[model samples]
Target: MKGNAELLARTDMIVAAGGGERDVAVDAAILTNKPKSANPEAFLNERLMSDLRPTLFLAQLSNLLAGNISIVHGVTGSSRTFMGEEAAGVDAVRVALARIEAGQSELALVGGSHNGEREDLLLLYDAGGHMLHAPFQPVWERRSGMVLGSLGAFLVLEARGHAEARNAKPLARLARVLSERSARPPGAVSAALTRMWQTLTPHGARAGMAVISGATGAQPATNEERAWLKSLAEVPVRATGSRVGHGLEPQFSMNIALATLALGREKLFPPADSSGVEREYEGPLERVAVTAVGHWRGEGMALVEAVT
Candidate 1:
C-alpha cells in the first residue's frame, strides 16, 4: 500500500478501537458561559466579577462528578490571568491531568475563557500541543483587532470502576486521549497541519478513522493551510467555525459538544450543517488536523485533537 493508504488504514483501526460507531450518553451535563442574561456587559461582569469564579466553579463542578473528571478551558488575554498564574495555554490542562494522575482530585474541571483583543482558543487530545500563549509574530502584531469574548466549559469524567461503584449512569467512556507536539514552527500553518497529522494517525499505524472540526477563516495563510490539508490522504475533515464563529473559549466547548454528540449518535456532524460553512472536504481525510491562527492574547495559539 502507498504511504497515504497505510496511514488511512491505521486511522481506521484507531477509530475502531476508540469505540467507533458507538453511541454514549453524557452521564452529566456540560454548561458553557450561559448565565441568566445574554447582554454583553452584564454577562461579562457576572463571569469576570463574581458569578463564575474559575477555581470555585471548578471545585463545585468537581463535586458533582462520580469519579475523575478532566476540565479544559481555553482563554485569551485578561481572563487567562484571572483563571490561574500559569503563563501557558495548556498549563491549566496539564494541571488537571497531573491531578488526575496523582489521585489528588477524583473529578477535575479543566477549561479556560478569555476576553481581550486578538483572542483564539483550541482543544487537543494531548496537552503538549496546546499553545498557552501566542508567540510574537511581526505580521500578526501589525493587525490591530482583538475583541475578547466570554466562553468556558467543564467536563465530568468518571472512571469505569468508579462509576460502577457509585452506580452512576455511564454516559461515555473515554477510550483514549493522545497529545503530541509537531516539529513545525509555532503558530505557522505547517505547524497546525503537522499536529493534525500526528493526531489522526492510528495506533501502531493500523486501521482507524476520525472526525475533526475547528475555526478556518480568511486570515493570512488560510489558503495555504487548506491546500496542505487537502493534499493529505483521504479522510473526513469538518470545520466547526461556521456555526460557532471564531474564538478559543467557545470553540473548546463547541468541539466538546460535537464529540459528545458523535459518541452518542455514532456519526459525524458536518461543519456545513453546524457552522454554516458552505465548502467542506470529506472522504479519506482520515488524518484529520485542526489549525487556529493568530495570538491568544496572554495564552498563545492552541491546536487540539480529540479522537475516540
Candidate 2:
C-alpha cells in the first residue's frame, strides 16, 4: 500500500536495505566470452563498460529506494537509509521513534526491504554457511542455518497527539524500543536481551502478554534467544520466520507490524512451530514484546501494548 496522501507528503522516511540484485546473465556472458577473446583483458573491460549501465549501478545504491518512494509517492520529507545486515532494521525504527519522542518529528515512515531470490545473494550467504540447503523447517526447530525470503515492509509511526489531531485511528501503542550490540560471545546475546527486557518492563511481564520473535533459525543466536525466552515462562512466543521465512533487513519492522495486528485483533495467531517453543494462546492479547536477535550481530526489543 502507498499510504494516505496527506500523511505521505510530510512523513520522514528511514529505510534499511542491502545491495541490489546483480545482472546474472551479463555476468555469465562475460565469463563465457572473455576467455575466448584474443585480448582477454581488453574484452573484459569493454563488456563491463557497456553492460553495466548507469541505471543498474544506481539500483545498487541503498538510498535509491527512498528517493524513488519520494518521487513516486510525493513523500518529499527528509530521508535516510541504513545498511548493516539486521541491525539496520532495528536502528531505522529506533531513530524514527527517538525523533518523534524528542519533538523533532511528528510523523515518520520506518522500515526496510530485502530481495532474497538472487544467485549472488544466495552464493554470498551459502559461502558463509548461513543458508539452509535441506528441506525447509520452522525457525525454532532448525538446528542451524536460515531460509531467506524476499519482502518489503514499512510502518507509519506518529506522535500520539499528532495522530489525534487528525482524528486518525491508532493501532497498538509503542511503549518502548531498545537496541544493543555485543561481541556475541557464548552468553552475550542472552545478556543483552535480559537488559533490554528489564528496561522495557521494569515491573516485570504482565498477563495477556505475548512475544513475536525474529529468530532467523541461525546457530547460536536462535539457541540463545530460545534460552532467554524461557525466562518469560507463560508468555506465548511466536517466531514469524516460520511463516514468512527470514527477510533480514525488514525482519524487525515485519515483526512489529505483526505485533500491532495481534494487539488490534486482541488475539495472537496460532503457533507456527510444533517444537515447545511456540504454543497456542487463546487469551485476549493486550501486550506484545517483539524481539530481534540478529543472526550475526545485533540485539533489540520493543514493547507494544493494546490501546485501551
Candidate 3:
C-alpha cells in the first residue's frame, strides 16, 4: 500500500483507539529522535543525505505516478547554505526538466530538506556555510530558533502520445512553465507590476483560471504580488497563502495541494486566518497563492479557498 493509505490507516487506528469521533479533526503529528554526531553541522548533513533525501525522492515518484504523496520534511539553518556554485531546489527542478526534455530520463524526482541546531547562539551552517537569518519584521521574533523540516515535491510528464495511449491519469495538463527574473530600477514597483500584469494576463486568457498566493506580515511585496494577480482580470482568480504563512517549501506543497484538489475534488481549501483582514475577492475565489519574506519555523502557513 502507498504511504498515504498507510497514514490514513494509522490515523484510523488512532481514531478507533479514541472511539472514532466523526467530528474530530486530526492533529498533525511528527516523530523524531536524536542521533549521535561530532558536531551539529555533521548531524544535519547526515540526516539530509540519509533520511530526508530518500524520503523526498520516493515522495516525488509517488506524486508523479499515483498522484498521492506525503511531504515528510524539516528545516534548519545549516541546510540553507549554498553548495559550491550550484543553486538548489527550484533551480534543480529547472535543470532536471531540461535534462528530461533532452531524453536524460523519462521522469525526474526533485526536492530538498533542511535542518538546524544552535551553535554558540548561531544556527548550524550547512557544508555550504550558509546560515539561517530571520526576516527583519518584529512579528518573527518568536520564530528565531532552531528548526528541522523536509520537503518532497515532484511531477510526472510523459511524451504526449505515450500518455494518450496509456490512458494514465494526469493531475494537471501543464501547458507551459516559464521562469522570469527582473532587476528593475530601485524604486520601480510600478514597472514590476506592469511586467507581471503583462505576463499573467495572457496566461490567464489561456487557462481561464489563476491562483494567487500572497505572503504574510509586513511584506508589502505580498500585496504587490496579489495586485499583479488581480490585474489579470481576464479569468477567475483564486488567492491562497495569507493563512498557512509563507516560505518556498510550504508554498510549493500548498500550491500542489490546491492544484490537486482543483483537479480532483473540484474544490479549494480555505486560506488560513492569520491577518485580521476578512477574505475579499469577487468571483470564484477557489485557488491560492503564497509568499515568504524571510525565515520561518513551526507549522508553515498557506492560503486556500475560504470555502472548501
| Model 1 C-alpha lDDT versus the unseen true structure | 0.35
User: Per-model C-alpha lDDT, please?
Assistant: 0.35, 0.89, 0.33
Q: What lDDT would candidate 3 get against the real structure?
A: 0.33
Better of 1 and 3 by lDDT: 1
Instruction: Tell me the tens digit of each residue's lDDT in model 3 across 153-231.
Output: 3444333444456565555443322233333233243344454344434444424244533233322333444454445
Residue range with the least summed lDDT across 10 consecutive positions in model 3: 12-21
Residue 249 error for model 1, in Å? 3.0
**Considering summed lDDT, which 10 consecutive residues are worst modelled in model 2?**
1-10
TM-score for each predicted model, relative to the true structure: 0.45, 0.95, 0.45
Q: What digit string (tens of lDDT, one per residue) describes model 1 on residues 1-308? A: 12333222221100000000111121111124433356756665554564444543443332222112111221111111113111222343444434555665444434443322321122221132322233322221212222223344444444345546756565444333323333335445555555545554534242224444443343333444455555544445454544444344334434444555554555555545422222354333222233333222222122222333
The list of candidate 1 runs beyond 4 A from truth reads 1-91, 112-152, 173-187, 199-208, 216-218, 273-308
Of 2 and 3, the candidate ranking higher by lDDT: 2
Best by TM-score: 2
RMSD score of candidate 1 (Å) = 16.2
